[model samples]
Target: MNPTKNSKRKTGRVFDPDATFLSNHPRLSIMILLFLYTVFLIVPSLLYTLFVTPIFYATHLYLLHIINFFSVAILWSIIVPLVLGLPNKREFIEYAKDIKIARIKPVLRSIGLGIITAFITLTCMLFANFLSSLLTGGQVQFVPQLLIHPGTTNIYTSLLLGIWEEVAFRGVMLVLILKIRSKRFSIISNGLLFGAFHSVNILSGFLGAILFGVEYNREHFIPVLFQIVYTAMLGTFLAYMFVKTKMLLPCIIAHYLIDALNTLVILNTEQLNWAYFCFMTFVGIGFLPMIINIPLVRSFSFWFPEPDDEIIPFFDTFLVRKQRLKQYKSDIRSA
Candidate 1:
């Protein structure tokens, strides 16, 4: 084939959404359109809340899992490419490379961090319980009934759920939002989404979600355990570690450990009593890193990540967004 003939031939791959009818802010439109994907997770959950258990009794169908399965599909297959709009196979390949999926160093480091993260979370919670007992005369019992046996099925399911939730929220959703929004915006919004990911307005979830938002400006993404001022502060530390090292595997590891153990804790909450919750209210000191890095944090606000001095070659989701942002700027200019 002649070069000229081949050049003229159209591969016809890109979606190339028509720009003529779009508003002045095409990117905003894309953002809003992508936001609707939340409904895919939410509505099914609402249905489950309303009818799943009763229907199971009536028809004996394992219908509850449908919501879970759909949630996974929406996160991986749909939301992962929510903004790209019909990109070809090559585009996705490039995207994976851009996100540093091929890089192994940070991942290994993240795994290591995860081990430490679990201990940190456990210490915080246990210390909270201990303090609660000392301050308010609360009975801290190692009651066998309180600690549910860690069944294999339950552990596996919880771990699997943790991985999926991380992949969806931090992995895909964070990357997508970073394209058009600032890093802080991406972190905060996704953190809130992380909180709301439970399909309800849970306070601890909300705190946990925002905990990591403060670290994005440094161009690192972190994952962590739980909520409240106590959980939030702990989350802040976990997020800070990820940002400093540009490793995420640790966060994911920390996530499942916290989730699995926390489930046992939640069940035994009443036994430990409300005094325990009140005891945990004294707050945690996880944000000491920021205080130590105080000068850097002075100019920063809640959503902004404190800038760090170290320059590292590690590539993670934040870098992926930087690439996307660069590309978006080019598109906006051309338009």
Candidate 2:
């Protein structure tokens, strides 16, 4: 049965049946999005383990990183749009707007916010490390890594990841959820899914360890679990940022900065213990952002968009008044 027959609205933009169907069946859309994303990540990782790593080994391992860069770009930047049925520029532009990457003003504001978040996250991390050192009687060591010090490949990878991940999680997935649910639900679900998505990395890591004949212990497993938890928290925070700011740029910037900074800063953990790791991962990087987001979520002054608010294409317009739109559609059906 054609579901799009009665789904028309006077929004005066392109009417895509696929988009309509996805909108109508939010669970199906989310599943498709997650399925596509997971397949790309897992397949490539397996390919790398089975093919690339054996050949590259150690010296040429940088090749895998380069491949990863192109793979992510292709998946999120190219394949996703095609899957969403955006076959042309105009349709793609509208999709971009839905993802909160269209307008310049909000993007600029996003950049500022991204910088602030990065600063706050880094400060918390450093402070956590210092406290860890103090309690454990370990000397705090600060080392600044340069872009070209070891190689520029990792730097590029970090930046590429920052952009593409936001595009996928916040831009695509979060927007999809927002279309069908409350803002709070969207942010929380997006964050949780985003964190769960990273669980694929644990599998990849295990495969790598197996390939190398290395014994995987709880030390490795536990850290990966911690990573998943912290990333979930971080994802939720980023989701909140995307919802509040209505732009993807800030999240991209923040994601990139945090990854890049973590890579560049080599903290000394010789005298530190699990307490340090737990505090830094759970409290500093995780809960801190969530704590910061609480106040913004509570503020209801400009919470939902009015009917007359300048429509920024799909996401914001449809999301802010989703209930009202449902009623409007119901009224139309009755009429």
Candidate 3:
């Protein structure tokens, strides 16, 4: 079937089918996108776990960190784009063009925002640690991590991750979702999938993803830096940077800085406990808009005695309006 020709408008729900790229074959588009991302992630992981790790273990030629770097670059960046871009060469070419650092204005803005977020993150960490220490009667102690691995491991790995992860998640996966579904669907799916992709820090990842989506929507998805502090999380900050600048440089730099900061911190049980609590708090705050977004949630909407306005009506556009008009006309004809 000619999916485009047969595309039908959607109404009465968060997901509007008609506004999507492949509205008539939503399922197929979703399957393809998921399959591509899955293959990219799985192939690299398998190659590392099965081949590279064993070779490193036996020969000790290269370290685990190097292996991880190559694996992520190959699977996440090199392989995924090559494999996915093959059939849709022209589309990818255009995507490559659109995905870049745009200009001086947004780049400066994003970098500043990233620095602020880093400071905020640091403050959050110290505050949480102090509160935890108080509760634990000053039992907390910073156990220095043995620098057994290569000293440059975190630096290189973080740099690689910042670059490739943005390329993979924001450049490739998010674009794929936007093409297949409405902006809301794309942002939500992109955010959730991005979180799931990390898997190491699922809650933080999820919160970061949602914040990224919200920022993109807030900016009207025009790739503009509309706000200074979009979302406080490092990952979300990266995503917002991408949206504003349309360039990966700011995102990569910010992302690397955030992860690189991790090298400076010491790990402890009490700190983790308080950090987790804080993480939950941030996520809860991010989702608070849902009180008005979802009518059901508004039933007992906590802070807002009167929910001010709709959360994200950004998805509504001329295309959706036209589709709705067509549907209205069709309904009258049927009657």
Candidate 4:
């Protein structure tokens, strides 16, 4: 029996479907746009920071600081979003439909997940720091800074870094790549990209990025809120916000809060205790709700009926036949 002539079986799902590509080529158009925009914004700003800023700062440090601050804000709030389509309002609202607070339960549930995620993240970081110390012959350092100091260059730098990174990795890269691939593939690819992008910070940043990717894929709401608790925790949070809220605004806000807190804490304190351990433990306990909800997430797959045992004509567009079991039941009830 010819497979194409068979009336019952459904067509094979597209792995890397032709429709996935915007153009008839290997490179996705959006990826190209992202690369170009990154170069255009980053190169000139770096040049100004290294070369031009020095000339002015040699004469007046205060003026130099002001210029750098404004430069960062402009880059984050204006330049990046304009160049890349981020924080799509329509997409954000649609994704938000999945989230609703009928009672306090959902909110509490999300908060619990946030807590668990925070604990796991801190535990991982501690282990990573210990390993690094053993390998590098240096004192292991794992501190959490909780606030940004007023009138400091570090604040601006952190802000710009957070904003640009969220825009690039979550808003642009993840969205564009996912548009061309399956959800699972896109999630994994985005996770890898998230981790690789932080290579400059070595193992600590890399590990952090991976966790962020995992949390983002698991639950989209609490991650954003969780990110506001710490700057180092921003990656996963922002990514989740991008996925769930589909808006860059929440991401930007989350990133800002995290970085601002870090800047404040680092400037005032010389050392931080392992209260991070306790914090993570508390958060990990909170993630219990999501752990319980896993079965529910899986159960959604069985709601659809099996496809009919007949070959269907291709209508130029791929369309899955709607399962009419509920409607059929309603009609029978009426009769």
Off by over 4 Å in 1: 1-38, 48-66, 82-90, 95-102, 106-108, 141-154, 176-199, 202-242, 265-275, 278-335
Q: Mark the regions of model 2 whose C-alpha exceeds 4 Å error after superposition.
A: 1-20, 52-55, 86-90, 146-154, 270-272, 293-335
Q: How many steric clashes between backbone atoms does each model show?
A: 1, 0, 3, 19
For TM-score, the strongest prediction is 2
Top lDDT: which candidate number?
A: 2
Give model 4 RMSD, 1 decimal: 14.8
Relative to the true structure, candidate 2 reaches a TM of: 0.76
RMSD of each: 14.5, 9.3, 15.7, 14.8
Positional deviation of 53 in candidate 2, in angstroms? Answer: 6.7
Against the true structure, candidate 3 reaches a TM-score of 0.52
TM-score, per-candidate, Cα-based: 0.52, 0.76, 0.52, 0.42
Candidate 3 lDDT score relative to the true structure: 0.45
Q: How accurate is candidate 2 locally (lDDT)?
A: 0.68
Writing each residue's lDDT as its tens digit, candidate 4 over 1-335 gives 78665643423222333222332221354456445544544444345445654446356544444554555445434543443223222222221221111112233333443343334343444443444445445464433332323344345555665555665566556655554465555545665555444433333233434533433232333333333333333343444434543345444544454344332222122333233333332332123322332333234223322332111233111223223655677889999
Q: Residues 1-335, candidate 2, lDDT per residue (tens digit)? A: 55695464223233345565555555676678777776776676567767654546466656666666677778776666655542222255456666767643533454666787887787777777777777776656645555433344245668666988898889887876666567877789888988888777777668768778888777677777777888888899889877776767778888888877764444566542677778777656888756865464336315334322233455556555766988999999999
TM-score of 4: 0.42
